[model samples]
Target chain A: MAIFYILLLFIITAAIIAVETKNLLSAVICVGAIGFGASLMFLFLRAPDIAITQIVVEVLGLIILIRVCISRELTFISGPREFFAVVVSVVIIFAIFLAGIKVLETLPAFGTPIFAEVPDAASQTYVEEGLRKTGAANLVASVILDFRAYDTLGEATVLFTAIIGATVILRKKTKKLLEEPDV
Target chain B: MKGMTIIVKIISGWVKVLIFLFGIYIILFGHLTPGGGFAGGVILASCYVLLMLAFGREFVEENLPLPLASKLDCVGALAFAVIAILGLVLGGSFFINFLYQKYLPGEALNLISAGTIPLSNLAIGLKVATSLFLVILVLSMFRPDMSGDKKE
Candidate 1:
């Protein structure tokens, strides 16, 4: 537990440094540090899959962000208003997620979330019958691919949409479009 | 963009194969191990990212090409969807483990005993690897104020 708190403290310090840094590249590296710190925390919590994911995602995101910061005149700075709006939007999104978790029965729930009251039906089913049903040693994989497969499909579609959006936005312009005067 | 120096190139060249193998191991043994599609896919993409860093973007892009990666991405997604649809049509439910009780029936904990999970992981792994590679490639190509709308 003390180690967990130390990891948390490290993450907080990195976050502060990330926010306070003058150099864009330093800030980006600090963000990566925070991600690695969180990944360590996840490992201590006995979730290696999430830890691996957090670390790789940190690497990928840092690569993208550093690419943007490199070879570009750094004039992008967010003011207090933009920060406040971002905070509000994030809070609202979390609230929506919380509401969805509260109302949706299909969403997975933990037995401890309700103070052990009634031992969550969905997760209980998974624990008792998941291995026998799916034949997969890793319950996480079985649950992700079998019982909640629609959810996996949704996630894949989301990724596809993001890639498509990035491609469309960053694609090179054709000759006709470039020859025409800027609209 | 020009790649890094000799040390980075030599080290990454030797290390990239091992990393690629590790990513494949993660995806293939996902049902038996900790990592699944997403983690393995990111690892695979990072392998390519390392190549891009060591050998330059122009060389990497020339090998993989944008259109081929895009098609592989679509193929991965389509394969996943088709698997789910097959379950619905054959087993009478969406995403059902039709093979678990039939052709895939065997002892538990084996590599090939996870029914559709390994297959799904393979598809998702392919999708994620190609999608992330495509996104990074496109983002790397982005040069603001080039021939497009002038931000100045």
Candidate 2:
């Protein structure tokens, strides 16, 4: 759709600005804009859950990034090596784009189910029997929480580990300070 | 960090409560709605972050102290584990919907009928909200050197 293209354009523009901006704060803001645009695209694609997650995660990430940026000098002018790296990345992106176009041509048209050629048994089962099995109105929630719960548990553990690591690493000085109060 | 202007503080004081309520609603209605534990938890964390931004770290800490946040984080994880362990005991499988068929009738689209799914969501929401708040709080506590020099 035209709206998708418009959102894509906005995303591309924001991403470029995020990458090219000298000021770290502006770059962070631009990155947030890109996230917003991408979440809108996700919404257009009818994945409301993904969109909500994406937007919320993006906001949280933006806040952390802004906090980090605030603790340091903002100007981040790219050096010659960084410019060269950018050029190399652009070339790689173009190559990938060309390859993707060729690959996409061989595939089904956009919005057409790729598994139409072969019956999507997995998704069909989830769609038809998911409610009966899980009793949740939201199929995605049922799938994640009930069906693929082990994966969710693993993700939760990962989050816990990450927080613990961060706390241990960042709180080292505070721990030392607390231990040696006389100093 | 010193907070923003008085106007921002006043507005955030009013807005934070609504944000927390909305987050709870999202978590509670997760099985029937788009948002689940993670999204709702992030929103809840954002409410706290907003309050911190508007009313300084000290004020925010006074309300939800670091120790309490840490305790909640542990409690959330423990709750989730206990649920999973219960499922294992009841259904012979980890994270099984054991309560769905036996105790609670499988009534479609009802809030209380989702069995352990809503319980899991609540646990995850609590864990995520507290952990995120802790991360932000700890990060904010650090007074990093702005001169690009390593701390001795």
Candidate 3:
């Protein structure tokens, strides 16, 4: 759709601004804008759950980024070698993008349920039986919490582990602060 | 970090309560709505972050305290584990809908009819909200400049 294409363009532009900006604060703000644009795209795709999650996660991530940026000096200078590296990376990324487009051309058009001559059996089943099996009106919630509960548990465990790791790593600084007197 | 201006503080004072209530609503209605534990939890954490920004670290510490948040984080995880374990004990499977047939007897789309789902959402919301707040609180404690750093 034209609207989707416009949203995609906005996201791309925001991403470019985020990457190209010299000011860390502006870059962070641009990244947040890109996230908002992408969440809008998710909404356009009929995924309100993902859109909500994306927006909230983006805001939290932006807060952390701003906190980090506030503590550190902002300027980042690139050497010739770094510029060369960027060029190489951009070329490699373009190559991959072209390959992806070729591959996509071989597949069915977007939003058409049939894929590779086979029906979308998994989604069809979830759509048909999700409400009856889970007794939750929100199919996305039922799918994540009921049918895919194990995956959700694993994700929760992963989050817990990340927090634990952060705590352990940061605990040392606090302990060192407590043990030492004022300099 | 120092607190923000007086206008910002006064506005955040009023807004934070509404944010907390909205987060609770999102968590409670997760089963029938778009939002779930993770989104609601992040919103709740944002409330704490807002308080920290508006009222300074000392004020937030006086109200919530880091130790209490860490304890709540552990409790949330433990509660989630207990819910899953209960399923295993009663239904013979991990994270099964054990309470569906027994307690939550109502028509679909009702708030009280989602079996263990609402309970799981509550546990997860608590865990996520507390853990995220703890992360931000700890990060805020670490000053980049040791010479200028002041421990509260």
Candidate 4:
């Protein structure tokens, strides 16, 4: 568990360096690696749901970044002194840690037996009738798709919106093709 | 083109195949394991990155046609929606596990069970693969042509 934190810090450091680096392509690849490392840390913390979500979202973000770089010829140019960057990053990390610790102190133990008291009547019913009624191997899938399906549908619609948004932003300049008078 | 070392070529080939095999394994055992459709899909897309590194963008684009890939993505998304629709028609809630309850037998950890989990994984696998491939392909197409550079 301690090692997971170490890995997380290391990944964060790598991501910072990647963002500050002068090469766009290397930064993109490093960002992807950082996402993978953070996901590994999430798994170590026994939060598979968060890990999966992080992986998917991070990958999507990276793909978008890479596309932007390729289309715009955007290569990062390293600026300013290294000391300043390090100082700023350290302050940011410390502030985040302080905020996170404060937040953590206020929350109840998520995985303890105490939290289990909240009767999952809906989840239990699904587990009981899922196989016979829905035939899903994993109960979460049944819950997401069957019981709480409207939420999933809403999420899918959100994803569709993002896709449309990305498509609109990345739309190629058709004037270049049209103006080139019949090749 | 300059000839590469034999070791580089062998390692590249091995990495791609390993990632591909591991990805398929994850998709197949998605119900029983830590990974599922999304993870498997990303793993599968990584093989193309390996291909891009070893053989370049042209090889990837040639192997994975853009129009065909997008169509596969559409099909996979439709499959996901259709399964939910089927549940609705069967008098179950949208994306219900009606088939799972009827078909699956034995314990929770068993492979033969999980009803539509496997199907969902397959659908997601296709969607992930096609969409990621399209993204990479489209991006690579716009990469600056650096053919005239001298060896560093």
The candidate that wins on TM-score is 3
Query: Could you report the DockQ of all the candidates, in the order they appear?
Result: 0.59, 0.58, 0.55, 0.23
Ranking by DockQ: 1, 2, 3, 4
Q: What lDDT score is found at residue A4 in candidate 1?
A: 83
Docking class of 4: acceptable
Q: Candidate 3, residues A1-183: lDDT per residue as tens digits?
A: 898989999999999999887787889899999999999999999999889889988988998888878745535634345778879998999999999999989877777757334666677777888888778898888888877888878877898899878877777557642232343
Error of 1 at B101 (Å): 2.3
Report the lDDT tens digits of candidate 4 across residue range B1-152: 32245676678877887878988887777766567777777778777766775676666767876667767877978888887787778736667665665544445667666666677778777777767766665555444433222223
Model 2 lDDT at residue B110? 83
Of 1 and 3, the candidate ahead on DockQ is 1
lDDT of 4 by residue, A26-126 (tens): 88889888988988888888767558757865766686677567634446565667898889998999999999999988767645543345586555667
- lDDT score for residue A173 of model 1: 54
Question: Candidates 3 and 4: which is better by DockQ?
Answer: 3
lDDT tens readout by residue for model 2, B9-97: 88888888899999999999999989999899999999999988888888988898777788899899899999999999998888889
Query: For every candidate, what is the interface RMSD in angstroms?
Result: 4.2, 2.8, 3.2, 5.1
Which 10-residue span in candidate 1 chain B carries the lowest summed lDDT?
B143-152
Clashes of each: 0, 0, 0, 15
Error of 3 at B143 (Å): 2.3
Better of 2 and 3 by lDDT: 2
